[model samples]
Target: MIAPRFTAALACGLALAGPASAGTSLVIDAASGAVLSSENAAQPWHPASTTKMMTAYLALKAVREGRIGLETAIPASKLAASQPRVKVYIKAGQEVTLDNALRIMMVKSANDISYVIAEGVGGNVENFVAMMNAEAARLGMRDSHFTNPNGWHDPDQQVSARDLAILAMALMREFPDYSDYWNTGAVQLGKQLLLNTNGLVGRYPGVGGMKTGFVCASGFNVVATATRNGRTLIAVVLGALSGTERTVKAAQLLDDGFSKWGGGYTLASLPSQGGRAQSICGDVRRKGGGVALADDADSSGPIAAQAQDIGGNASDGGRFATAAAPTQFSSSVLTRLPSGKISLGPRAEMTPVPVAFGRTPGSASAPLAANVTGEADSRVARGNAPVIAPSAPVAAGLFGTQTGGLYADRGRTASGNGAIPGSTTAFAPADSASTQPGESSGPMRLQGAVRSGAAAPASLRAGAAAGIKPMPRPAARPLLVKPSPKAEPAKAGAASRKPAQAAAKPQAAKPQARPKTKPDDDA
Candidate 1:
């Protein structure tokens, strides 16, 4: 099988990660299928980049069915190599086996790999996507539909965290052989050390395998799995702040869940919490971070493939207001019900945010998600990708009117110049002022927030016109005069920026040193 020299035949890369605009977050115990904790678990949302979870699910099904084997090699054709954004640097016509494809696709969350796998498996992405939908239907994911392989911006594609949890659980049981792929820490693909994006894989106790996702529409989301005392638990935390928050929240949830359930876990206990009466769906709706852009905006970070609560107050001081911020999201059975209606979780004085997800576009400058890792990433793990509904929302009997995989609250009102939530209030906008493309009317600018320090074209944030007070840019470092470029190191793999042969120009460019291979459909 054709395997990259750097990446072990085991697992591969990271994917985007972010949440919706509003404040939202959720946690669930996969084995029991319970909604342990949540903010707006039922609200419609943009599935962002988490859509890759579904893509991986479909591909894994093929792997398990013997249609494609781990050792089976497929080439990264020009078409696949041409995919934009996230990718593994595979040259055109360079053969990559099914196993390595999954590794790179999962760990790196390479869009290019997705395109190649789609074509190799179904002759084309359109056809492979058909298989994805078929599998979704078979899995009883009636509320879901897939429009792309990598979970980029496609309003038509979506999924809810609940449904995502279902898929995560299914993968755990249906394909035990592939489970090890998720737990991979990093792949030593030649000189490059491709690290796993999931923070807890090797850092946290009991954390096993899983995935994370993000995009422009969705926020940071992770299907976090952990095992403690022989009791395995998969905690899916959708739409968080940054990479660190996603894993930390998942770990906290697992800690709480294992502390209480360990051997006593059950489906009935899925809707666990710290101290509140959660609804059938969950507790407080799960959410990402909030950005104080120029306008009244919600979570404006990079939304993953599958991926809010909107909050704010503008009248506190002149036109300046504040927004609701996200809290530490975690999963655990209710410790003691707070004395209240429990419509929302208890509001303590934490970091207040205007939107649910991260800082709005003007302030949200980091990458919301990382790439996928392992032989197969999860489908629902696609991070936040903004979802703009059509004038006529798509409807069907199986999914119900106003029903889709995930949901976003498009009706939340906001105030101008809001800070973090708590003291914020909604106010009307000045009629003469118009919104800029990247800036929201909320306190934060909603136009250009992205994780990984990447960004959308400036054109996307052009709609808003008011000069948004941009987030404090990172401190500028004095540029030191660079030394003249030296001879490049010779050990880098095909993934490096410099040419592979430039560093170690072997006598005449030839494949004499190429590693021998035996098909590893089972790797």
Candidate 2:
């Protein structure tokens, strides 16, 4: 038996090593694979949805290998359709293009779409899982393993912060062309619009693209990449207490790494440890008399408004009229890692609470239903403008009071104009009045007839006699006059023709007087 003092010390050590040891984080230089900052970087942790990163990697690999093309159609299988919420709800028989599937998987974090992609690329879910592990191992990710294509919680599925960083860097290096898929803030699928689960995409400046994950066993996790001033850094934050904390901590790590980025220790130089944190799952109490909250909030909740706005703008030929390409990687930095054997440690086993359908792994709430489609644009546009009821007919002498009346009848036919007979008001012919008092009325004269300028049109007088209310007139506008250029002195022979020219010019007609009416006639 151990001595009493030794036993007491062992208990203290075990207690100290509980949940506090679970939170692992790391930041690495994307170019050199150098480790800039780390905390329990080697400790095993659940990947949650970040597992989809590996899924994406394999799909891209297939595309590069010509096993599949971006345009290849992927049919949804029964297994794929059976996936829980946060999905596009593709019918099992329905097929989506490989490119679209990848976008949906990344932007929506849909488990169903992941399976669809897996089946399309690897022929089946099991094969896809095998391919994922094979790729992870090939990339020196000994501490990482994948059991499912969509990252549904399984005791065997796990990845360390360091391993995740390696996978992220490998993806950037191996496939630069498809980088936009991961960085997309949102995607449109027919009528449905799915917003990205990765918070840093639009929220953090300089953050290009990445993946976020959460599971009860993993807490909250994110593998984020950011570039600034030619330097790019990848941050792996695992077991964060909350989604906000996960984003904040990842941002903080990137900031610190970028600040001290020049010449750091290589990833191979970092120490490795075995065993997973058992207490990292639920809410953990911290030192400040506050508890570290579990990531109970849905990641999509904060971005719903943004998603709606984007969907609404898609149809208007506005900001999203054209498909947006992903932000490109900054100029490449030449940094190489020293050759060394990557240490592989024993795998740690922890009981994983299976993430249920309709709810994300660690989130307490289900994702908001983002069924936003083209109709959203119409809805939003309708909401923005005030609705106007039909106005009552304008009274007889109430012309020149409404706006836009001057040109209102310009597009209408004579019969369409609701002119009233015997009404005091009428629509002035285009040639009769000048928009501006002293502006040149070029081409205003009719070739033959010389009707009175103020006379109402025959159609207007007929309508008025039939008791149709006269069309409302436009609001009076201030008339502006440009001074006519001083007439040049007439030439010698031109004086005799001046009288004829004056006679040829059309004269402005005088205003016609209205007939006096009895009091009853005024009605």
Candidate 3:
């Protein structure tokens, strides 16, 4: 028989271990910091690129304090250039505007770009990292620390789901004016276009701007926000298996939180372990443990593969294996909630400011219209293709309808400008040759000839009209003559008369050889 005191202590130990060992997830009301649901909220995990949030926060703070303007030039340094992959590849001494650098860092998740901004704003990466930690502690993110601005993997650079939630909330609440920065789906840097990595940006309905991060050690993580019926909520998901899985799980969490939202306990009421998250990097097959429930039941069982689907139907329990079950409440929980809706936010309407390089710091330039056409000429001269700015409104119909996988328009030639011919917005030279059948003597004329089944030119036109002269057209190619078919071979028995005919035809005499000529003396 076991002692009553021992059994009671054992039960308490199991209960405490439940929440401590569960995977990290949390949802809270952005306005009141109310915790709607959470699991393993305080377990420390690698922040990955999500560290950009802190970097961005500090940058925005600096902007508010008048320390740096949006147009301030931030030069890339050797330290900034040495960062690992997922970088903008900006060389040392080159500079990017603070505004453009932030967009590139967030949208592209560029490691080097983060460093550029870090050095520019924080005076050095170490100083910036120090500022990040100081701010983290000030915001009550006790379980978080920063070793780098870009969130590149370092054992010391870490954050908990709760800490991330706090940072995200502070970002939204503190910098309402810059909400569109993270909200934007894509940005254009000269000819290079970068799309946001946050899959929930355009896919999940009402989902607003946030960030996403990933590394082998951290798996995939996201701090996502959504608004519906004038109510806004934020969800943090960590240690997901794939990009799709992270997004789907985050969406499901938002769906569950919103469905059950009724102003519950505030963020301060939720428990915190104040410890680092258990490293699952060594256990590749233990993905199921990340989303486990904080209860004594075997909720850590492997989630079904179907739960990975973003549009998958939920089970009768009102939960997909990928989504954490709602924490028990005094009221009965609804078995089913409305299906996840498409994010109807204004993400489509938001446009990133065009990033220009080589401009003097703080000098103003005319706003380039999205429909502007002549910019490609200079880019082409420099051997860099210009991209046609997208002008169409966001596509409608369903989630992820904006565009196919991150579209990149390297650059276009004068003739190949990405616009309809004859339009004012068309990017072509005044002397651009018409390809019409009756017209001739222009760059496109050869193309017209080929399309019309007429004689084609040896080469197409080259060079823009305003710069280098076009190469001369090569001489037209001569047509080849076809050989006639050979006559049938003579039959074996019928060929005997050919010898007599040959002797009669070859009776001509040979001429005598001429004397060899000597070198002329004075001809």
Candidate 4:
């Protein structure tokens, strides 16, 4: 059968993004290749920024095919720098290192940087994009296309939630270093430090690096990843309305995926009612691979590990290539991984409960859905993990805030404080230096004069003094917390009373002892 096409991808995507459907979400075990939880997994829709996954895929392939190197420099032409929003603002003639440019584009989601790199690697924007389409076809990205490197918007640029999940896995497998940037919390470019748009990077448990995309037509789209035990899973949520909504939705999907113990069925149980279950190539039980999960070893309720009679179909993207693909600029050169730190394990396992299969197709309990697709093969293995089912609703809201206005206000506050309280705290979580004005939040205390040219009280002052004027002195935290009014009298008395006051007139002048007068010095 012919593979799905780009135009059909957009039409099919729009058709799938119904109000009732909200498009489908999938949480697949990257290791076992098992479907943990699926909601409308077949729907199609505009890919938004997640389309960059295809872009990254092709770029990595070029690296694999001998075309570009991470250190290769690309010039920003008038056309390349014209795009706006989330940019490092490279001027037309300025040269940006390919490695740094991608760090800006992937970590910061810079539209202009993408164009610059596309041209830098392919010699021109259009030709680089042609490479993107060519690579997508080669990878069997049936429901995808690229008119622009930065997913600004076009009926022509489209991908399905399922295809996106597959694409994400491919990128992770192909370009480990480049993919690691997706998890980067922020980027540093001269005067400006751009933060990652993916909220799941530091907030939700197990979630790592991935990309975020938005457009009026696509709402919000995110290709999210998480790791627990040794297993890593990818979730694709398309057409979400807000960043918070996207993370929460993605987290919910991850929870469902990690919740399964993937307990093994007896060899007989695996065969199913009639024929041998279509074998996925990399299921953990397969020859050399196994799925990884954290915590539960034996089982988590009834795992959705039941086998199916698929017609032996497998993902077109091949198994994890044992060796890293060759780089474009040179075979010997390998791009160094970007440095960034962030992670929180998936939430502690909830009480073990039965997984509901009513809404799910091919669940452990329900007969595999009638509409089940073809047979598949994968290399996956068993690992301990907490159980959460996707069919259930996720109760928590996502982190990150609205764009501009309150968002900018929050960023100013969170960065100042050092810790972004995320969506939960009263005062946005801030770094300690933010608590003291004119100081940074993270680490590395300023050796210079702090506020009033005085020393910072504690060593906690770590971060930038960028926006603050002269900075403020670190005030005692007690002052910020309301002090009791009644204690004022006691505190004042203690300050005023002299050390001599505590001594009586010696009850009398004992032997008329002469006492030395101590000088009163406030300085």
Highest TM-score against the true fold, candidate: 3
TM-score of each: 0.49, 0.52, 0.56, 0.49
What's the C-alpha lDDT at position 43 in model 1? 36
Pairs in steric clash, model 3: 44-276, 44-277, 204-343, 205-342, 205-343, 206-343, 206-344, 385-411, 386-411
Q: For residues 8-68, could you state the per-residue lDDT of candidate 1 as single tens digits?
A: 2111110011223432444544333333444433333445445666776666655433344
The RMSD (Cα, Å) of candidate 1 is 24.1
**Which portions of model 4 show Cα errors greater than 4 Å?**
1-21, 261-523
TM-score between model 3 and native: 0.56
Question: For candidate 4, what is the lDDT?
Answer: 0.41
Each model's lDDT comes to 0.39, 0.48, 0.50, 0.41
Worst 10 residues of 4 by lDDT: 391-400
Off by over 4 Å in 3: 1-22, 283-305, 308-353, 360-523
| Local lDDT at 297 for model 3 | 9
CA displacement after TM-score superposition, residue 215 of candidate 2 (Å): 1.5
Poorly placed runs, candidate 1 (over 4 Å): 1-20, 261-523
lDDT, model 1, position 485: 39
Q: Rate residue 354 of model 2 by lDDT.
A: 10
How well does model 3 score by local distance difference test?
Answer: 0.50
